[model samples]
Target: MRTAWLAERRSRSPAAHKTMDKIVTLLAKELRIQPRQAQVTLELLDGGNTVPFIARYRKERTGSLDEEQIRQVEARAQYLRNLEKRRAEILQSVAGQGKLTPGLEQQLQQATKMQELEDLYLPYRPKKQTKARLARQKGLEPLAGCIVLQQDTKETPAALGAAFVDPGKDVPDAAAAWQGALWIVAEDIADEASLRALARKTLWDGARLTAELMTDERAGKDFLLYKEY
Candidate 1:
């Protein structure tokens, strides 16, 4: 509970959360509990006061959580604070772009992950070459929409797609028109908040951690340490 709470608090970030997670792992190792289970206890133990003070004064309640564990918890807590700070910066950047819609804002607030936020921001974030941008330059948005609504019971997709193909607008064919529309639909589905939430739930609950030694690099000779996340 403690570890998970801290992790949830830090989930919006990448670099900082990653550092914090490592510290949490160290704390867990010191305390002899799995990292998944230690985060909550570490959070609770570090909720208030200094490490020296906590170690000296609150030993009995924390299962004798020692100086090392206290240090690990404090380091993890500081990293989490940094993650929140960076998240604010990222949000401000996105907002400044004038592309932050209400739905996008809602997703940003509810996102449990930096990767998901990045993915959600991909459409709005500046990029040089994309199919939609090129298609729009060729003036294909309306034609695309026409094909997208082709499934309407009142009008056929092919008929609607055919009706809007302005040769002057560079709409090459019904296929090209619908292809652009399909791109939009795919991005919308990928960035949907509900879809993201379900996927995140699966990642948190279904994923398992694995690790291996760093034998080929700088630590090849060191029996002292080798680890993976």
Candidate 2:
């Protein structure tokens, strides 16, 4: 039976095997159990055994793991499976866009959390018909790049934008070019995942919540206790 299970596991795709190993290792470390314990529990769970049934009847197989431990393993295994699914989808999406480099693919594969994967993929994600798209349509991306590079050029941003002023492209004047460039720059800034993550952390760690009473009489009566405290 063990040999058959091992053969079946070997027949699975390499990625599936990798995900299984990762889940087993992570579960063992997090639950402070032996790897054999986590592995057998996962096998039992995968075989459609109920947590209660396993805890009640499969003590020998599970190394005597309790219901709570088995439940935690089940829940964590589900979450890890879902996370792996999302990771594969993101990798395929980025590859489809022709933007998946080795470094990026490695980062995506190594990301242990959903937020990390999302943050890394933010800049490559498709956007709506946004200001950046409109600006790119007007051929202002180069100007945006120049602004970002901040190279040693005698020409100011407005002066550089003046060269891109083409009425045919709807950029009638330097001002229009500058505006489009600024929009592109703003979109790039918004898409910067690290900056967004830093901002989120700062606000979450330092920001305070305040509650205000409504001016309505019913609101005052409903939140009477909050009015003073």
Best candidate per TM-score, number? Answer: 2
Q: Per-residue CA lDDT of candidate 2, range 1-229, in tens?
A: 5566667877899879888898899999988999899999998877667899999999998999999999999999898888899999999999999999998999998988888888888888887898778989989999988879888998886789899999998999989998898899998887776787898899999998777676875857878667634
Candidate 1 deviant stretches above 4 angstroms: 1-65, 101-112, 142-151, 197-229
Q: Evaluate all candidate structures by whole-model CA lDDT and list the values in order.
A: 0.64, 0.88
Can you give the lDDT of residue 191 in candidate 1? 57
Clashes of 1: 5
lDDT value, candidate 1, whole model: 0.64
Candidate 1 per-residue C-alpha lDDT over 1-229 given as tens digits, one digit per residue, 9 for 90 to 100: 5566556776656765665676566557755756754565465554545677667876665566677776766665565455455566667878898777887788776654556666666556667776767677766666656544654457666765666566677666777667776665565566565677688899999998876765665655554343554
**How close is every model to the real structure, measured as TM-score?**
0.50, 0.88
Candidate 1's error at 100, in angstroms? 3.5
